[model samples]
Target: MNGGVLRVKHHLVGGFSTVTLCPKVTDHVREEIKAFLLNKANAKAALQMQQPAFDYDEEVEEPRPSQPNLKKRKGPMDKFVAPTPPDVLKGRKDRKDIFGVCDKEERDNACRAIAKWFYDAAIPFNAANYDSFKEALELVGRYGSGFKPPSMYELRVPFLIKEVEEVENQLVEHKTEWAAKGCSIMSDGWRDSVVQKDIINFLVNSPKGSVFIKSVDVSEAVKDANLLFSMLDRMVDEVGEANVVQVVTDNASNYVKAGKFISV
Candidate 1:
């Protein structure tokens, strides 16, 4: 996520700046963590056994309605915790043997690091559930410890360009399908509660799949049906009006009028 670009008087630099990450944890700390985790596992097992057994056979009775608690809830500030500074990162020493076995201490240290990065970054817990996360770990493991992570400049410039190229490669297949069978111009607008702005997203969909064109901040003209129609019209023109089968948008009053005007 750390990324940026640098320019010398409006021209981009060819060479990338790299950072060598080295996180150091003592062997004593590793032992403490291992012992604590072992205790936690045993505690979890005991708690599961102590739980009350459910009697499904005895109860088919309707549940009683409960009254809502009107008592004042605790304020958000009461539970707030200030963020702490992150520790310096370090790359673990790689094994000499390419197919070497990892010992218990090494394995524990690796797990500790993986969890630490996620926590420090404030990444969503569910992000680990995605297949891409697993694939990324697998790919990185192949290189062992020799991988030099990109500096902020390299990530935003070179790496960013690589990611865009990968996405564009995938979109090419969808564009081919669009030429064969007419595609639908799907669009929707909603207020982004965080940024407090109205934004619209446009996509082209066919039997193959949908490809998101772009997102636009439309807060200024959200209420103007004529402007909305014109925006949608331009999108249709971009995708080729003759090839577009339909224009799909939300049922919001302004959007409905805009869609109707486009249809006419």
Candidate 2:
């Protein structure tokens, strides 16, 4: 045999015989062994391919990692572009500047006059504070007539009171005239500093040629049914009951009661 070697061995334990073949086997034997091995390996591989793959259900897939939330950074100009303070505060500062140089006497006089103007005009004390008084003085100085010397005070209380009273009297007269021609009345309650709660009464009418709104304030106690009825009675006394048409009011229980009482 060309480059072929054969060996025989006997196992002592099991009494088995073994034969080993080397690369130098005879050509015919080598070919036959090779063919047999090739066929056997191919058959084993094909069987394995035809069989179902074993899957390990115990294998677990991991969840994807969460990403960090990133906020957008503000630009450099954000601070500078912030909103300024309100105009009301700026207006107060400006008024304080105007009243800054006044003497104590002039300032006191101004305050008193301003306070009276507010009282007569029904402006609240809190609203007519120092700054507001100064602003009012400035407004009067700009718009009012007849300029007097510093000794007389630029915007006098007496002058404002007189003007306010005159206007009030004119309004009252006009309202009374409308009432005389027969008008509907509307009344509601409001609060004031001096009077915690007062009734604000008004009149409305549209005749063949006249339409008007007239108003007045009554004491808090007078907001009751008797008082409201009495007020209407007084109007009826003046204008006659036949001329009175209707009374309108808000949805307050008291007002509803008053309306029923009036209707009777």
Candidate 3:
């Protein structure tokens, strides 16, 4: 009817009739169909251009597929960026305040007491016990909110060295005063029980008190009169030869000879 003739054919397959149409189009109808198709294609292309293509540069988060009844897990970076606990912040503040409020003299006295406990009792230090000891001290005083203990290294080295130097200075002052009045010098040797090494210790007794001078390790095979004489001579030079009233030593044969040599 629209400038085209339709031819129809009917066939039976699988117990159903199927009809097919073959249209014989005229030149005018064929041209009309081509124009409509071209217009529709052009309109489709314009619509696509107006709507914009997906941008490869822009980031778009894809929705994650979720389980029916499970919580989402946190990523490593999310846990890292999480806020710190309130108690941790409070503890840091409390620590600074505790030190600021503590009396310096009391702190010094406590440190001395701790040193004496380890020194006088001859108790060896164990680094492993530090945390437990620190906790105990904290429990006894302020609740660990702001207390720290001396490290094992500080206790063994710097602090002990400082204390020893202070005492040595005091002793030196005392000796300078008393050495002028003359002092009796004594020497004795013994073997260390632990390492079985021979050691000789020297002391000077003045009107003030008996003060230890020095110790020499005589464990070498060359423990003879010359070694003894040299050790005693060094003491004489240190104590001042004129201030030494008498030199005394155990009646060991080597010490007896060393005494005679010094007397000369």
Which stretches of model 3 miss by more than 4 angstroms?
Answer: 1-147, 156-158
User: Which has the greatest TM-score?
Assistant: 1
Where model 2 places Cα greater than 4 Å from the true spot, the runs are 1-146, 149-169, 172-182, 192-195, 198-224, 238-243
What C-alpha lDDT do the candidate models reach, one value each? 0.61, 0.50, 0.62
Ranking by TM-score: 1, 3, 2
lDDT of 2 by residue, 12-116 (tens): 111112322343546565445444443443454345445734333321111111111212233455332322122222354466664465644665786787678
- TM-score for candidate 3: 0.43
Question: lDDT per residue, candidate 1, 194-262, as tens digits?
Answer: 989988899999998889999988777646788789889999998887779999998888889998899
Residue 86 shift from truth in candidate 3, angstroms: 35
lDDT digits (tens) for residues 108-134 of candidate 3: 787788888888878777832778677
Residue 129 displacement in candidate 3 (angstroms)? 21
* Residue 123 in candidate 1, Cα distance off native in Å: 2.6
Residue 158 of candidate 3: its Cα lDDT? 99
RMSD of 3: 34.9
